[model samples]
Target chain A: MPTHRRIDVSKVGDVTVVTFLDKKILDETGIQELGAELFSLVEQDNRRSLLLDFADVDFLSSAALGKLITLDRKVKSAQGRLKMCNIKPEILEVFQITKLNKVFDIRAGEAEAIAAF
Target chain B: MTDHISAAGWQRTFELKSDRGASRAVMDVLLEQLGAHDWEPSDIFAIHLAAEEALVNAIIHGNKLDSTKKVHVDCRVSRDHVRIEITDEGQGFDPASVPDCTLEERLEAPSGRGVMLMRSFMTRIAYNAKGNSVVLEKSRAAAAG
Candidate 1:
């Protein structure tokens, strides 16, 4: 297991659960660091079946969405799965407005996401 | 660079560098003032997200993060309304020309969603002809019951 800063990594029945550590995911440098760490899960650790829980995240910019889109592509190319859960209503509105709800697998809670995966 | 409180509202102007840190600092003060004026959390979130997208567009897309170029921000927060204008020093693009990110073929693209997000969240968003300058506003009266 490698040291992580932007996300907390845990496992639930072979599925990797990742939680964001920041309330606001807007800063460019921070978003870059976050993207690298997330990509490393598939690139470095070779982990499949990832779940992103956004309970602690209160805000995110469009740049952050860009990273998630790239990560979804990576996971698909790697033949793995990616899902997200616990997104706040306002943040969920961002996904809806961008129509990203159709792109990524999103669940209402951690258990539901984990079960789906 | 100038910030003051008037009987009508709180106002501030900032000449920021083409750096994310500088922009984040400016956002902090804007958010704090929104809170001080008793804006609802949901409204605050909308303003925060919209302002951030506009700032990033001005800094990264408009100014290209040029150290020599500066991004000018003008903001006013009142009990029933909030407005912010951001302008960058660059050869601007036409806002109308930005392809819709929600298009089926363009949905997966990693970029080009900033302008769309700004338009969706704010009560009104407008760009100057040069496209280097943008104004974002939210009307609390409209949002409230």
Candidate 2:
């Protein structure tokens, strides 16, 4: 059965980190239901660097991609940054096709993404 | 018009969440049970994708995170087809204006692909206005040519 994997949030130094432990974000099909939640965070006043750690994610759908872009733009407009770390190749391919690879700051790992700032 | 098929090959209905994100397990179980009814791989993927799109819309847009709101799904299988109905608690929108994802203008956008893909993969698709429900239909092929 598909489960809506929990997404844990934390503040690491200057970055507000979101860790996804499941390969699939949506309970059934990799679609994400957390768009509004992330958007709510991006729209917050005390915005810090946002780091998305996908250490356990192997796939993400286009809808999930939409939510990321929405948050990425929201943070950037607030003078902050959106950087991602630990994305699987299969999922990265989706990003590549959507031209998001050029739009988002994607890193090989958390250390690199955090260092890029 | 509402399209439907009644088959005893499989039957199940589950309810818990206002958001489609919460009804995923039900989707997986339905897919597996439908497979046992002789549904093909392509049939399974198509139904899975359609259900994903429908349920997400019902939960995200229909229920709007009102946990009190419920999203209901019913799956039934007959001799050679699988039918699914997904209903939500909110007022539905106009399906006429959804952008065609196949167009060059939207090929890169992250959303809007759900409705388009659902239409393409399913044999028949219908929406009930008053009920805020999306019905999906797909036919299964027989074992012998």
Candidate 3:
């Protein structure tokens, strides 16, 4: 089953961390859910920096990558930079193959990723 | 069809149908199983994208959306790799005859992204002369979880 375990958006000093604890992200339906959640997060929080921790994510789909692009754009629109950390190498390749790697601030680990902004 | 699967480690099989929704779901399930065996999310996405394109080709171009036709999804997973077999009940086309998606002539259009994505994600993807099946394989580092 596709599960979203947790999503918390909190500010650490001036940076915002949107932690997504999930098992898998596949199909358009799941992407829609994530898109909605992220849209709301951005709308309510005017904060300009966001972080996505995929420590719990086991899988991702193109539909999900589409949503990630959407999130990156949304954050950038707010003058905030969006970064992803703890992502598995395979998933990172998805970003690369799709050119999303160039689009998003993907970090090898969280601490370095968060500090980039 | 039963003989196609039943190995250990990780494996699952599902019958594909005319429904686009079902095809996508089956791909998701297979990839999730692969992920449980430590496949990376990026690699799974690549597999999923390739599977999507292959399935769409089977439904739209191959079978022409005939409800009577079927697509079979067979997948196997291990710590370092995942392999997928998608079989369609239609007159298979030659993968070689298709135009490359990356070519400058075709880049302006939107239709050929599927084959390109498939080839990009998996280490190996091949089509048999029977044109009834496509096999996709992606080799990558195992996920920590």
> Which candidate achieves the best DockQ against the true structure?
1
Per-candidate DockQ versus the true complex? Answer: 0.90, 0.17, 0.13
Supply the global lDDT for candidate 2. Answer: 0.70
Candidates 2 and 3 compared: the better one by DockQ is 2
Provide the interface RMSD of candidate 3 in angstroms, 1 decimal place: 4.8
Candidate 1 structure quality by residue, lDDT tens digits, B1-145: 7778998999999999998767887888999999999999999998998899888888888899899999999999999899999999999889899899999999999988888988887899999998899999999886674
Tens digits of per-residue lDDT for model 3 on A1-117?
123334656677677777774566654455677777776666665667788888878676655665776777777788778888998776676566555666677887878887888
Alpha carbon deviation, residue B42, candidate 3 (Å): 10
Q: Estimate the TM-score of every prediction.
A: 0.97, 0.58, 0.62
| Model 3, residue B102: C-alpha shift (Å) | 8.7
Candidate 3 residue pairs in backbone clash: A48-A80, A90-B42, A90-B43, A91-B42, B92-B131
Candidates' interface RMSDs, in order?
0.7, 5.2, 4.8
Report the Cα lDDT for residue A28, model 3.
Answer: 45
Highest lDDT: give the candidate number.
1
lDDT of 1: 0.92
TM-score of chain B of 2: 0.84
How many angstroms is residue A84 displaced in model 1 relative to the true structure, after the best TM-score fit? Answer: 0.5
Model 2: per-residue lDDT, tens digit, A34-112?
A: 7655665666435568889998875455577777877877888888888998887656755654557777889998888
Lowest summed lDDT window (length 10), candidate 3 chain B: B104-113
> lDDT scores for all predictions?
0.92, 0.70, 0.69
